[model samples]
Each structure stands twice: as C-alpha cells, then as structure tokens.
Target: MTNPAIEAFVQEANDILETLEDQLLELEGSSDPAQVDAVFRALHTIKGSGSMFGFTRLSQFTHHFETAFDLIREGKLAIDGKLIDLSLKARDTMRRFVDLGGDNAEADQLSEAAEVKNLVAALQSLTNVTSAPETTEEGASQAGAASEIAVFDIWFKPAADDLRNGLRPDLLLGELEDLGDVTHRLDLTAVPSLEKLEPLQCYAAWAVTLTGATTEEAIKDVFIFADDSELEITKHEPPVAASEPELTTKTVAADKGKSNKTTAPIRVDSGRLDEVMDRLGELVIAQARLNQVTTRLADPMLEAVTEDIERLLTGLRDTTLSIRMMPIETVFGKFRRVVRDLSAELNKDIKLVTKGGETEIDKNVIDKLSEPLVHMIRNAIDHGVETREGRIEANKPEHGTVILSANQEGGEVLISLEDDGRGLNTEAIRARAIERGLLDANATPTEQELHQFIFAPGFSTAKELTSISGRGVGMDAVKTTVDSLRGNFKVHSQPGQGTKVTLHLPVSLAIIDGMLVRLGSDVFVIPLSAVQECVELDTLETNRESGRSMLRIRETLVPFLDLVDVFNYPESKDTRRRVVIVRAGNAPLGLIVDDILGQNQTVIKALSVYHRDVEGFAGATILGDGTVALIIDTAIMIRRALQQAKAQEAPSKYVAAGGH
Candidate 1:
C-alpha cells in the first residue's frame, strides 16, 4: 500500500503549486512584498515536506526554485518579466516532478531535460549578474563576524488526530535539529492507559532547547504545515555581562490570542460529505412517506407531529446543501494564466475581466464547469476577439476584452461570457449552414436561429485549421455538457460589437422544489421556478378545427403542449385537465396535464445511461407515496413545442406561396 504520509505530501504540494501560479501571475502586474513572501513560503513548505516524504527530486528542484525567490525576498534580485516567465516555467516543471512521486528514474530523466537545464541556467545567471561585488563582500563580512547564538525553548503538542492524518513528528523534529544544536525531552503525561490507548492517536508532547545562529523565521518554517499543533517558542538571549552571567528570557506564545478568540473551519473529505448527502436524501424520502401516512390517518396529534418533522427535515436539507456550495471565484482564479498564455501564443492583446465571482453554486456543478468555461474562453480569445490591427481599423480599443460574470436568479445561477470583439457573422454562418446541409439553401433564418448553427457538430466558419479552434468542436461540447447539467444556454451576438453566451442552471442537482402533475396513471414534476400559473385547459379552443395549439393568456399568445402527447403516454380518462403555464426565456409555455398533484420538495436522482438520451425529461424522482415520477426538462419541452409549431407552419406557408 502507498504510504499515507507521502500521499498527503503530494496532495498538499499540488495545492501549493496552484496557489503559486496565482501569486506569480499577480506578481507580473505588481510586485507586492506580501505576494513575494507568500511565493517563497509556499516553495519552502513544499521543499521541506517533500524531503520528509521521500520526494528527494522534488525537494532538490524546489530548493533551487526557492533560492531564486529568496533573493527576491531579500531585495537582491528584482522582479522582471524574464524572472516571472522563468518562475512560471519552473513551477510547471516542479509539478511534473511532484507527479512522478519523487526520486524515480523518470524524474531523474526530467531533471536532465533540456528545458530544465535552460531554466536553471537562466535562474543562476540572474543571481550571478545581480549580485554586486560590494554586496558579496558585505555578505562575506557578515558571515565572518561572530554571529549571535540565541537559545530557543520550544514546545510542540500534536493534535490527537494529527498522526492519523499522516503527520510525521519525528521528521519534523529532525528538520528542526538540522537548523541548530538541540536538546529534546518527551512528555507523555497525557498518554492513556494501555487498555484505553488508541494506536493512531498522538498523546505525547515535546520540549526542546536550541542554540543556533538561525532566525526565528527559519525555526517557524519547520512547522508551517502543522497549523493545528500547539506550539510555543521562547528566545533566551546570551548573558549581557560575563561578570553577571545571567541570560534574559522572553516568552512568545504561538498564536495564543488568535486561537482563543477564533474558531477555525475544519477541512472535510468530499467523499464523506457526499455520503452524508446520500443519507440525508434517504431520510427526506422516508419523511415524505411519513407525511403521506399521517395525512391518511387524519389524527390531529399525528398530523401535528408529522408537520413538525417536515419543517425540521426541510431546514436540515437546506443546511446540508449549503455545505456543498462554493463560490465560483475558485474556478475564476485559474483563468488568468490561460488568458496570459493564449495572448502570448496568438500575438493578440486581450484582457479577461470577471465579476460576481462571489456568487456560489454547488461544488459538483463547479467541478464540471471548468472545462466548458476554458473552451469558451479559448474560443473568445481565438475567434471572437479581433486582432490588434483589426481592432484599430474598426476604431475600437487595441486590446479586446472578455467579461466572465455570474449571478443567482431565484433557484438558478446564470453564468455569462461576453467578449468585445468581432461578434458572430450572421451571413457567413447562414451560408455555412447551407453548405453543410444543416439548412435549406433558400431558407431565411433569423439571427438567433442562424447563430445556433455554430453549436452544430463540425460546423465552422474558419478558412483554415489552427491549434486553437478551426475544427469546430468547442461550442458543441459546451452545449452537451450544459445539457447534462440540466441547464440551457443562450447565444446573443451583434456583428462588429460582441458575442455573449449565457447559461441558466439550477443551483443544485440533488434536490429541487417541484410542482407534481399527473399524466394518466403516471406522474411528472416541473421545477417550481419555471412555473408561472395553472389554468383549466379548454378542449373546444384546442380542437382540430382551430389548427392551432396556442393559448391566449391576458393578450399574450402562449403555446401549450399535452404531456401525454409529448411523452407518448396513454391517454387519460379524466374529463378535467389543467394547463400549467411556465415561462421559458421570454416565451410562456402551457403544459396540459390530467390534474395538478400539488407542490413537493423532490430529491432528484439522475437517469440511467439507457434513458439519459430520452429528451424532455431531466431525471427521475420518487414521490412521497413511493411511486416513481419523471422530472420534466421544461426548457427542452418548450423548445420542442416551438419547433413543432414551426414545422407545421412551414407547409402552410409553401402552399400559400404556390397559390400566390
């Protein structure tokens, strides 16, 4: 089995690398001292932890990388484009080494790779060239002088669960020993009796006295990753006078005030969170069944008890979901590196501006959104944004801009990518659709309809293929992913202005507020957020003589769909039916059902692969009565209804032209 300590090191190293990239990119804009220190500290922690966990190759490589940042920290080296570029490249190389699990033959080969050699050479050259003769002499003079050797009284107590989490206190103490002369003592007063002792729990503490020429910063670096540990350090100065021979001691409590005043949030494994959510879903289903039982019994006390349980369950469900919600900014931070690299490759000046990043969504949704968002940003930079010369010719700013923004709209989150570049070419797209046989040559499609052709598989307007996007697959993949998330996207563009694609998705996929409806003996659910109103279906107005499926609601022409016909279910025998009017985009769609079964809080379960391809159904859920009901994808149904109306109208239009 793989060592858990090594695994933890690898995971932490990956996290540090990600943070380093963000800091490095920020350094490019402004070289803030705090950011520089953060970069150095991250590298130091990686190197220190890598050494303890058998990542020798990674440790050594980061040692050199850390040295370069150390110079920046000490004001010996200046932050420049060349240094930042080298740092970013070196960061990527370090990531590869970390991936190799340290000290492997492949890592050795990578260490000797040409790119690695060049980066090291470049870094060494910077330090050599920037080191002035006087500065070197001054550093030599300081080293030659008798450095003050101070004694530090150190105490460390690891948390009970620290060892189980893969913390190696011995390795940590060894690291401290390398810093200076040390005498150590172990305190086992907290250890439990043999019968009660837990092998994995850490109950021992340590006290040590270290005499060293090292600074306090160097000593603290040893425990940088052990934030949960209780640690204290006291500095004891050497005797002020030989005659008196008395040392002065000053005690410094490590984060004592902060620890006492604040509570730190615990880091939880996502898998555990998922398990809790699954159990909560089962409880919700059971509670719903209890409600059904109580209502049937019609006992006052039982009904009151069931009502209280329902309210408690509702609150519990909301709290569980909130635990899985994370702000979108976590995904936004990585895009800066993308835009920077793309701009360099394409030789175009572009900027990415993001807003509403604090808006939160389900973690699962955010995880799946990264790739689609990357593809969209790449498309915007490669195709949407005009080149520098082209922008100048159009009297626009030389630097094009892409704006990524998100916000919450009721039960859904709306994420939009807008680019100020050459927008969709409607005429060109229309012609391309005809050439690709996606549309009739004589067909005249509206701008919105024509714009959709960009999402068609293998559709492209580019004359030649490039590394970026000529082989048109990006937007189509975006659509597929959004659909899988039960979300819908809209494309709006104006030639010479810009293009904006907005995605509307539910806040969570686990549960939703649904309006249950009956179709024959089967039941279906419509997301309550999409429902506008319910009205009685008029059979006379919907008869064959009218040749129309439109319902006029308060001066608006709203199209309606029979759920039975849409799902191809058997007809119902019920004489009365209701129409649930829902707003889809700017249009209102009426869904005709046999009866309205009232509102329900549904725990959504995704459809199996076999039924996933079936349109007009988002997923399935179990009702309070233990019956299965399919959740309606109202957006898809509305689109289908409109398409059917268009198909029927086309034949009539052709006949009218023939008569004319």
Candidate 2:
C-alpha cells in the first residue's frame, strides 16, 4: 500500500535536497555562518522526518551527513572544497534513498553500496568523528553546548487521527530529547474513560521544558513535517549562575517579532496553476465574442457593460499571469552548482556572473528552459572557454567568465548566456559547413550565417566526443526548444573576444495582443508586438522592373512578402491591398495582405499535430465571428522572406560574374 504520509514525506524531502544543494553551493563562495546553519538545519530536518516516515536508509545516511555540518557549527571543522564536494555527493545519495520510496530491499542494497560507504567515510574523515551508536534523544541533547544552554517551553497537540495517519510522537519526543535536557509530561486530561474510549482516537497532548544551547528554529524543525499539529515554542534565558538555579523568561523579542510580519505561502501544485490558465484563456475567447456582439447592438448601456467586462477580464488576466510568474533566479541559482562542478572536472578556472535574476518569467517557460540552459552552459565551458594556459598567452585573465543575464524587453523576456573566451572560429565553422554540404564552398556567407550552422543536427567542431558534449545534439536541442516556445534566438561573436546567444520569448503563451488581417476570404492574426505600421502597397512602386519585392518605408528599403503567393492562397483582386511593416531583429519586413481587420486579444491555441508542420502559421485561434484564423509566426515569415530574397540575389550575382 502507498502511504500518503510517506508520499508527502518523500516530496518534502526532495524539496529539501534541492535547497540543500543551493545552500552548499553558496557556502562554497562564502563561509557565511547563516548559510552553514541553514544547511545543517535542512539535513537535521531530513534525518528527523525520514525515520518517522519509514525512510530508514535515508534517515540513517543523513544522520552521518548531519554530524559533519554539526562539527562545522561547533567550530570543529572549517568549510573547504573537499567538504563541499563530499556534502554534494552525500546529498545525492540521500536523494537516491528517497527515490527508492522506502523499498527495504533496494534501500538496504544502496545503503551497503561502495559509493555510500565511501561518502560516509569521507564525511567522517573531515570531522574525525567515528561512526558510533547513539540514540536520537542523546544526539539532540548533545547538539548544542551546555555553556550556552537556553530553555524552551514546547506544547504540541497532534490531530485526533494523526496516529492512524502515521504520526510518530514518540520518535518526535526522542528527537527533542536529543536536543537538550528535557522534562516532558503527557497531558491525558482529554482522554476518555476506558469504558467509553475509542482505541484509535488520539486523546493525549504534551507539554515539555527543554534546556539546551539550541535556537527556537531547532525546536520548530522537530515539528516541520507535522503541519496538522499545533506547536508553540517560547524561549527562556539560561540561569546567570549555577548556584542560582531559578531562571527568568527572556522574551527574545526579535524572534517573536518576526512571526507576525508575514503570512505563510501555501504550497500549490503547478498542474492546478496550468488548469487555471487554460480556463482563463477560454474565458478570454468568450469575452471577445461578447465584445463583437455588443459592437453590433450599438446600445449605450450594453456597450458600457461590454467595456466593463473587457476591463475586468484584462485585470483578471494580468493577475492570473502574475500568479504564474516566478523570478528567474530560481533557474539561475542551480547553474552555480553546474559551473562549479564543470570547472573542477574540466580543470579550468571559470567564473559565472549572473545579473537581472529578479526578472520574472512564466512558470511554464521557466520549467522548460532549464535543460536548454544547462546544455548551453556546458557548451560554453567545454568548447567556448579556453584552457588557463591558452588564456595567459592571449593576454587575458587565467580564469574565463560566463555571464548569464535576464531582463524584460517590451512584451518579451530576453535571456542571454555570454562567455568571455575564444569566440567562435568563423573560418573553422565555414570549413565544417562546406564539408557537411550545409553551404557551398564557393559561396561567401556572412559570419552570422556561418554561426547558424552550429545549430544544425549533428554539427560540431569537436574532434572527439566527450562525456560532456560533442554528440552535436545540444545546440540543435536548444534551437528546437526555443522554436517550440514560439521564441527566437540570435548569436553574435567576435573572434578572440567572446560569444553571446540571446533568446527572445513572449511574456505569456496563453493570450497575446494580435493584429487581425485578411487575405482572400481567410483571416490571420499577426503578433502586434512585431507589427510597426500598416501602409498601402503602391502598385507603381511595386511594378518597377527591379524584379525585387521591396517596400520603401520612409527612406529605408524593407523586403516585402505577398501573403497570397507565400501561402499559395488564390490571388485577391482587392486594390485596397495593404502591407504590414514588422521588425525582425534589426531588419524590417512588409507583409502584403488583402485588408486590415483591426486588433484583437487572441487566445492562442496550439496547432494540432496535423498542421504543426506547416511553416508560416504559429497556431490557430477562433475569431469572435465563429471563424477560425491562423496565427502568423512573424519571426518565421520574416526569416523565410529574407532567405528567398537572398536566393534571388545569389543567382543574379553569379550571372553578373559569369558575364565578366
């Protein structure tokens, strides 16, 4: 049987392990006392709770892990690279134990594994603390020094069904005893008379006086996993002299003051957030329909009501999106560990500098972004960064630097990974491209064009495959993921300077502000963020014999694409043909359409598998008039048009050269 309590414990333990990693990594950069305490407390919590929830192996393993940090807390050990590395490995072992979900056979095997033995021995060696038998009660009391002992009055009352649900009060009390000298009394006043008592009901409570050099936080950690229980802890000052045994209550105002400052946030499943967003998208589509109907009615009160609805919906949408928005720091924090590990393994001195971590992105985007970012970071370390010796010869610092930054740019979020190393070798990339038949040997391509070849499947400059990379799948996967998010990326490099790749993604995928346009009885939606302005396609200017489809907007010549020809739609005879000027990167493109249909709040629906392969259309959405319209991927269309233009110019240039 799957015990719900055990399941919850596993989930919480995993979360703690993640946090433990971050704390350990942070501790490496600075020997912050608070960070050290946090790490110790996390390990202690895992050990205490793991035993109660049947994670015997995990609990036993963490006990040893906690002892190392305990020594650090007591000034018996110092933070160093060796200790941090062992802690990381020990943390991973604990994670594996938790992953076993208390399967005794597997847990036993893992507990006896050589790796676990090595990790424990390594951890013990650091503290010079032998593996000795000790009870939880003894451990808790010995956790803090008697010289600095503080007394705490702790009252705990478990829920009526807590015992049935696997609450181990005995183990909890033992853990408390482990913290210090303890005087605990069971309050049985609520227990029913034996004749009328229900055997399964919990009718007891506890009041305990604990004197130790432990903080209130330590006491709370004892009850961390028992959310259903009522716990109150008050700290009292230690006796001034051994002869004067009587102690007075010390308010410890600072700790008490922090309790009332903020409300606790509830843990919510991300699946529920996704459901809310899906429903919100549907509500938006319905509101668009109502707005369209109200426009036709032209009644003053109805129009006012429609306007109010729109405003309310807009506010609700913003609020919902904000709820799903998480600071990008959550993702950025993990990379510190990655960089540290990679630097050690690769034997290179590389520093990771992050900025703008407070920038927010939708949770969904953040979840999918981690893997791609990991690949890019690895690529930067393994390929882009030069060896320390190479760096010295290049007149650079011995250590290479990788900068990971995030910020909001208009309606999109821009995340960039830049490395100050030997930038991409354009000549080498060009040669590889020609050898791979990705480019013509005789053709001259721009640096950017040559860089694009790196994203092709199975494209790599590595002479041999290493465990880190060289399979040539990392960059290709990055491109695929960014494209799936309806985002685009750009690469820039200066040969001996560095390389920077920036990704541009929408703030939200559920709803978008789109411009509606029509072409030969079909309606389409263009992302409004990309659209600059709409202008009439002058026939006289377009008919010139230059054999180029270009539009002169003001003084700049921008490439233009006819939607009818691009999509193979029947030609429209509408003389009122208009062109929508949209910017893609630094270049602008004009899209020719039949007519303008104003703006819309489009609830974007992802394309079905059947139509997903279609090049230009990003997705489909139902219009207010009950018609389905395809959403144009402005970035894709602009790229396609530019490619076509380049192809056309290529042939003409070749012919001119042949004539010469």
- The candidate scoring highest on lDDT is 2
Give the alpha carbon lDDT tens digit for every residue of 101-182 in model 1: 8798998999898988888888788777545333456555554332568788888888778888777788888888877899
TM-score of 1: 0.88
Summed over model 1, clashes come to 0
Mark the regions of model 1 whose C-alpha exceeds 4 Å error after superposition: 129-165, 168-213, 236-263, 539-548, 570-573, 651-660
Provide the TM-score for each candidate, comma-separated.
Answer: 0.88, 0.88
lDDT of 2 by residue, 453-550 (tens): 78888889888889998888899888888877778778899878999999888888878899999998889999988889888886425532245577
Question: Which pairs clash in model 1?
Answer: none
lDDT against true structure, model 1 = 0.82
Estimate the TM-score for candidate 2: 0.88
Model 2 bad stretches (over 4 Å)? 1-4, 129-154, 159-166, 179-183, 190-203, 209-221, 224-262, 543-548, 651-660
Q: Please report, in order, the local distance difference test score of every candidate based on alpha carbons.
A: 0.82, 0.83
